[model samples]
Target chain A: MKRIMILVLAITTGLGVLAYTTHSAPQADDVKVISITAKKFDFTPGEITVKKGVPVALELTSSDRVHGFSFPDFKLTAKIEPGKVTRVVFTPDKTGEFTFSCNIFCGSGHEEMAGRLIVTD
Target chain B: MKKLVLAITVLLVIALMIGVGVFKLGLVPVNADVPPSGLETRFIPIAVHASVANHAEEQPNPMVPTDENLIAGGEVYTVMCARCHGVPGRGPSVLGASFYPPAPQFTVQPSGYSEGELFWIVKHGIRNTGMPAWGRLLSDQDIWHVVAVLRRLNSLPSAVENSRSKLH
Candidate 1:
């Protein structure tokens, strides 16, 4: 009975550690780099598509004022300031349609400053 | 009596097993886009409040609410909190609402937390939430200044409001 209990504890602990360590690390594939431009209230490439489970590198630049790129689906956000390139890297874990929007209150059309991210499996 | 106890134990074990299986199977929704359930909105704050109570020190804000401090706070807020918490005149931040717990819209609804509580939250941040600890990036004075700004969001001085307005 003592040995059985010890074995169960060991297995549970091992499984917990394995799950924690190996859950979100995707294999090293060529990062799909995409450049996005932000202005008053819009992303230049209004729509972006990438493969699920692959790493993506986004090079974000702003032409005027400070803009925020918020992709809530992936819990990603970056500040795009004029005269600076903000690089954001993330792996899309889910395959679906996600909306990326400017969170910063830029101007009258800030609400409409949104784009779509289609992650394909 | 023995049989009844045994049966109850077996039933409890089965229910526990089912609960663990459901969680492990990913039946629980983790999507950030969906509005938080009533249970989450109600229970999570309770946990946060208790944790804050335990960890937060009862330190009063050292910074006075002068134009200089308030304006400084506004600047920090614009660069840091505005994206998640929102700014004045922007109706219901879409990005703020998209977080799992949803970042509080300080512009629309002023924080009810006390100066000390707000200070602790801003400095340390809530765990497992969208809030990030600014202690590393911002100085202690900056945190206190922002706390003052939060306390006066509804009634910011004209100078501070004007500076914020220029951003929009």
Candidate 2:
């Protein structure tokens, strides 16, 4: 009977902590949304600034050809197809500057496609 | 255990010998005159992709595309880039053929590089090619001006045409 009581207390304590943690964190839907346009070899409004801990919804639009958008530091990659909108929701946990680039091959100057994301504490 | 170690050692030495032989014998094509092998052609794109993706600048071309800016860009292009890239109404340049991977003709091939992309290329230039880094020679504003001119490489605006000198 004592063992059973101890096991039940432990389980209840674990459940309480899990519930608190889940409720404290922000959800993807709660983050702010920003639209970015990707063209032959550049992204408009190249520098983006966001607050740490808050999630952001990035809507990517390709103006001309199919381009790739990748935040290598964050291990995030998204494809931006012409005439289509690609939505990516991410929460930056750390505070620093991150570079995002196009991993796909477009043309001769394809390599010069990169942008920066600045996160503040 | 001793026999196993001996066998492994023999195999390792054999592999090293083969590697050395390939290098000393000149079995691999090292000359730029030779067209790139199939494997090299396949690999070069991946290497260039990784390099450009890593180094490209994020900022858009800061200089506004004014008429003066375009003319300056045209003059710079005719001076710095035309020796290899060729100029308008002048047939292919003899120097263009000298390069292993021939210098691209802007009149024939229009690279869809962005303004910033063009600026970066003109400033830093490409490696393993005839292109040389102009960043040390040109200022940032001048590079942007060059990019403005490249935008209309094939279809030169009248103003850009007026900017070109007879020497080009």
Candidate 3:
């Protein structure tokens, strides 16, 4: 009975360690950095292209008013306030066109604020 | 005695499973989707200011709160902030209503920030929210003036109440 209990504990502990190590391992892909600026309900350079399997680091800023950067498909959103720099990082696993839009209502033309991220193989 | 020990062991395993499940699957509140109202909007700024005051070791603002300075700030607020925050007797703007966290009707109750705290937020702005920092476009004095204006917002002359009748 004692040997059986010891064996069960060893198995559980081994499994837990394996899970932790696998989860903490870094990916093999490279990272690309993209800088974007928001002003007057629009994002400057409204489109970006990145390679699939690469991580993206988005450095964002705002010149006027507060704006929200939202990618609905990715369930990601961040607010860019005037005179502040914000950073968001994500890995694009699939190749597709992802829509990005401003969620904040800055002015009359707020609805037209949009951008696109094209991920390629 | 053997049966009683087996029952206790089963109960302990069940309790451990429940604990693990609760930790893994966060129990979100049922009303998590319900949006906050105008009154609740003030809480963010108040909380932020209090936290900054408690934790941030920064210099306090140097602007003197003269009546002239306040009047200048009021003018700036009327031109810039009044649309969303609203003027006296008017409600928040149409755009303000659609925000996930609705903008506060500053006319009802002025922001609970001290003069210095208000100046810092206006100059540096809040992160991940629709509050813009005026530091780039407006000079330091300009932001300070806006702060002075926000201080006196409760006593300002009433504007025409067009917002009450306007469609959101």
Candidate with top lDDT is 1
Quote each prediction's TM-score.
0.55, 0.50, 0.39
lDDT of 1 by residue, A1-121 (tens): 9999999999999999999888956544668889999997789899999999888999999999888887768878777899999999988988989888876555456657888989999
Candidate 1 vs candidate 3, lDDT winner: 1
The C-alpha stretches of model 2 lying farther than 4 A from their native spots are A1-121, B1-16, B25-27
- True lDDT of residue A51, candidate 2: 93
Chain A, model 2: TM: 0.75
Per-residue lDDT of candidate 2, residues B1-168 (tens digit) = 999999999999999999999999999665666665687678876786567657777667777778887776776677678888888777677687567667778866776666766777777788877787765445566688778777777676777687675444
- What is residue B59's positional error in candidate 2, in angstroms? 2.8
Tens digits of per-residue lDDT for model 1 on B1-168? 999999999999999999999999999877787778899888989999888888888877899899998987887777677878888767668888888788899888888787888888987888878888665445567689889988887789899999866755
Model 3, chain B: what is the TM-score? 0.58
Q: How close is candidate 2 to the true structure, as a TM-score?
A: 0.50
Model 1 has a DockQ score of 0.02
Best by TM-score: 1
Instruction: Assess candidate 1 and give its lDDT.
Output: 0.83
Fnat values, candidates in order: 0.00, 0.00, 0.00
- TM-score-best of 2 and 3: 2
Per-candidate TM-score, chain A: 0.75, 0.75, 0.74
